[model samples]
Target: MTIKNQYGIVKIAIASGKGGTGKTTLATNLAAYLSGKQKIILADLDVEEPNSGLFIRVERKHEEIMYKMIPGWEEDKCTFCGLCQEVCNFNAVLNMGKLILVYPELCHSCYACSELCPEGALPMKKQRMGVLKHFSNGKINFIESKLDIGQEQAVPLIAQTLDYVDKHSENESLVILDSPPGTSCPVIEATKEADKILLVTEPTPFGLHDLKLAVETMEKLDKEFVVVLNRYGVGNAGVEEYCKENDIRIIAMIPDDRQVAELYARGKLVYKKSSAFREALDRIAEYILEN
Candidate 1:
């Protein structure tokens, strides 16, 4: 199926401009709320630091290693020609007359050089970047990805996970994707095809600044977007002011409570059936269901 299809399901992305903005907190709660109401897939696309699993206990299903295809050289088939170098746009392939160099770090793994090699000297190779973890929390399908340390690119892993979700979701279940904190490539990758994005933020200056960055990204992406303010009274009112000035909707505001932090530290969720966070989240969730 095409990535654009969205499998006739609402794909909601919970993201943030900076870390420590309660991104995963909101995501986990939203996923839990939706899972009980209907079928759902909760995917943590923050490959570098996947912490959603810490909040929700799940049985680990079988996982598989995720690989990326890079280019390799077969020295025996080399003709010393410059076709490989000419076709490579990433500057990953280098031809120095007698010696040819392949820089894996600079490679985009586009395979242009390998495909155009006149002598068929270059072949594609796989590099283990990370693993795709499959999990199940009763009715909810949980997907959390972990990037191997020092891996430069996480967009590929995020793409692979999205593709896997599209292929695996045979029913019209909501896909709640928990994205990395930031407006970087990884965040963009996670929210690129999302049906709706909830930008989580606090009430401080940094929160407003980073939310602006995330808003800029959403404007460029041109997707349906909203904002969720977490820990409302802990910081200044900068976030609310910014949203009001920009005409952006504040979908929900979760009050700052010490009990929430204590529960989070103990690996417990704060958004329960009677909690204010869950009530606000349920209202925001209705947008997906009603739309």
Candidate 2:
């Protein structure tokens, strides 16, 4: 299934409109389906709250602290000029009468303040954002990041997660990214370099509504993507209708089954119990190869 130009590596991002929409389920299953036959790595980029490993259970191979650069002020230079605060576009730097404050949460690490400082009063300092873990069950490698609880910004941590994947990505293999929900900056960062994205949504009004928003986000990124209608039987007809009207292809429709839900709740995968899901995932692999 390797294309001549493709290094046999496929980067597929599975994202949803909002949380609790089964993005990780589809991502892990897809990676599980490709195990043994192809080199596959599953990355959980939902740094704020990651749970992909609760099911796969790979032995943790490595872990690292992910950090971002924040400005550090030098009071010894003797100046309360507030130049750093004035240059910061994110409002991360604030100056008081004699105290210079650098809010790490609001900083984007652009280094603009340090670059523009006259006396080099500001130097970039590292702040811990999260921890990244690496593991492998022989065939599928897993990497996930967990943002420090109460951490407000996730983009820096998400970058570290992807950086690990990019640095450790297996040659001639596939990378399946489980992105955080919503059309925010973190989600955008996850989907940036993906060759194709699988947008998973249900058949309800909320599903359709957020699906559209996600679709717009993908279009803005100019990346090719397809839709996955999960729990197809329970929701309304809007999912299919919207796909038809928008010329979007429906790659797979997973039925709402008590068995699957129960297995998921127990941290079990469907392929361990049902052959149908395995077959469906094989079909999805073929769809990715074809398109």
Q: Candidate 2 clashing pairs?
A: none
| Per-residue lDDT over 60-122 for candidate 1, one digit per residue giving the tens place of the 0 to 100 score | 986999988887788889988889889888888899988789876577788889888888788
Regions more than 4 Å wrong, model 1: 1-8, 80-91, 94-101
Looking at model 1, the pairs that clash are none
User: lDDT (CA) for every model shown?
Assistant: 0.84, 0.85
**lDDT per residue as tens, model 2, 1-291:** 542125656788999988877888888878876776877889999888899998887788998888888878888873878788899898889989698888888888899988788878888888888889999978889999998876789888887788889888767778889999999899999999888899999999999999999999999999899998887799799989999999999988887778888888988877667766776677678777875
Error of 2 at 112 (Å): 2.1
What candidate 2 gets wrong by more than 4 Å, as runs, is 1-5
lDDT winner: 2
What's model 1's TM-score? 0.90
The per-residue C-alpha lDDT of model 2 at residue 182 equals: 100
